[model samples]
Target: MTTALDTTDRRARQVRQALWIGFALQLAVALVPLIDLVTFDSITEHVRAAYPDWSADDVALDRNAITWSLVGIGALGCVGWLIALALAKRPTASRITVTALFALGLVTSLTLLSMGGEGYDLVVPLAHGLFTLLPLLAGLTAVVAVWQRRR
Candidate 1:
């Protein structure tokens, strides 16, 4: 017969598994920004198109800044995921951290999305915007998995 201990152990295993899956997804998403950095030359035209008034040197500087910003954001997100994973055995702490991270990700993504052609006058390439938002999936999964009630 299945005892409460057995059920709790199974649930803990499931939570850890879910945390690992979230970490994997987060790591994969983190690479997207690095890939963009590797192919920085290809994005120059898009940046130029967005800010036609900017000089060649200006464009280069802006592109570098944008790419690096995305990379930094991705790296920080990966770190947060790792922290959540590390705390997975402590379900309350893990859930709280994951939920907070998810909220932060949502806010960051939305802020980035709203930051173009208006007050900020910064136009990010479509790929960059998407890259910024991709971590939400990872964060969301972790949040849901950790917060799920024991069955």
Candidate 2:
């Protein structure tokens, strides 16, 4: 019953919704702790438990670094999300914003992977994986959706 125009409109709406959900989910992960019990205990607690050989002090130190890094990562994503939300109507800005997010995601992913368990089940490494991949995925999705919209 839908015309091509209707279908295209639907697709555009879906793309916007995807960006919104991605933005919200990412913002929650970066800005809030203890949501869905995804707190400091989420991954680090596991690593700390598995590595009794290290002091609680060692775990605490690493936790600080991870937390701050995630915060920075989250801030950049937030900016990109805002840009996408505001300028999705404008393909040029949307593309640039999404590209920035993708670059940031790439750097974060590689650095986290490199830092994983060089000395330690690498259990906490899971956090690094999540932190690395989530934004990367979101960014990639944003870029693709916007590019498609331009067509």
Candidate 3:
């Protein structure tokens, strides 16, 4: 009962949905870093507690640097996802956007994983681990869904 055009429309809709979900996930990832920027004092306290010998001043500085880095990266992710969302209707642009998002997701995830030992604090580790995995899942899903569609 479904014409070719109907099938195409369905696939397009699915791709659009996937891209938007990916955008939302990326937005969540972006917000997590902003949250860190605001609650960094608690993180510093955790780090200071874990490393007694480390000065509070030093811990605070390190925490600030980490939080800033995350914020910057997260902002970049938001931009990438926004671009992808905007281009979702154009097959080539969509593919490029999807690929870029996947690459960013991979880099971001790996970077977060590499910082696993730095979590020192329970909250830090948990937040970092969860955010890292989430982006990877969302990016992969978006890429696969888009890739499988007929252009």
Candidate 4:
């Protein structure tokens, strides 16, 4: 038989685990962009190979824009994740973080969809989309779990 205190402690543990999962998802989101930036040359080379008519200057310009955009987004994600980590002990603040992550995911998805076929190849775009989506799902789950346990 579980007492109210036992149930509360169990729920608290679940929330903490969920929050950690959220942090990990955000960390992955943050790293993906940084990885893209670091591997820009390789990626561009592949892109150029795919489209033989694209000039080096054109590829460089496009790659630059994409890399910078990714860095900016990733930086924001890192900050948000860090804040969420800091707020793990505060359920309300943690819920806010989840909300923020959902917003970020929506924005990223819209931007990517609007870009169409211009910037990156299919794989990069798909990967970015997945990165955003996975974190959003994690955030949503954590938020729901936290909400259910609110007293």
Candidate lDDT scores, in order, read: 0.70, 0.63, 0.69, 0.65
lDDT of 2 by residue, 12-130 (tens): 66557767877876786576433323644654565466566778788767666656666666677677777677876665776676676667667766765655465554523565556
Q: Ranking under lDDT, best-scoring first?
A: 1, 3, 4, 2
Query: In each prediction, how many residue pairs overlap at the backbone (N, C-alpha, C within less than 3 A)?
Result: 0, 0, 0, 0
Lowest lDDT 10-mer window, candidate 2? 32-41
Query: Best candidate, lDDT-wise?
Result: 1
Q: Which residue segments of model 3 deviate by more than 4 Å? A: 36-42, 115-126, 149-151
Pairs of residues clashing in candidate 1? none
Report the error of model 4 at residue 37, Å.
5.4
RMSD of each: 2.6, 4.1, 3.4, 3.6
The parts of candidate 1 lying over 4 Å away from their true place are 40-42, 117-122
| Candidate 2 runs further than 4 Å off | 1-12, 31-54, 116-124, 149-151
Candidate 3's C-alpha lDDT?
0.69
Candidate 4: where are CA atoms >4 Å away? 34-54, 117-124
Question: 1-151 in candidate 4: lDDT tens per residue?
Answer: 7787777677667766766776687677767766876765554664565566888887777666655676677567667666766776676776776667657766875565455554345524555655666666666666666667534
**TM per prediction:** 0.81, 0.65, 0.77, 0.70
Query: Of the pair 2 and 3, which is ahead by TM-score?
Result: 3
Global local distance difference test of model 2: 0.63
Whichever of 1 and 2 has more TM-score, that candidate is 1
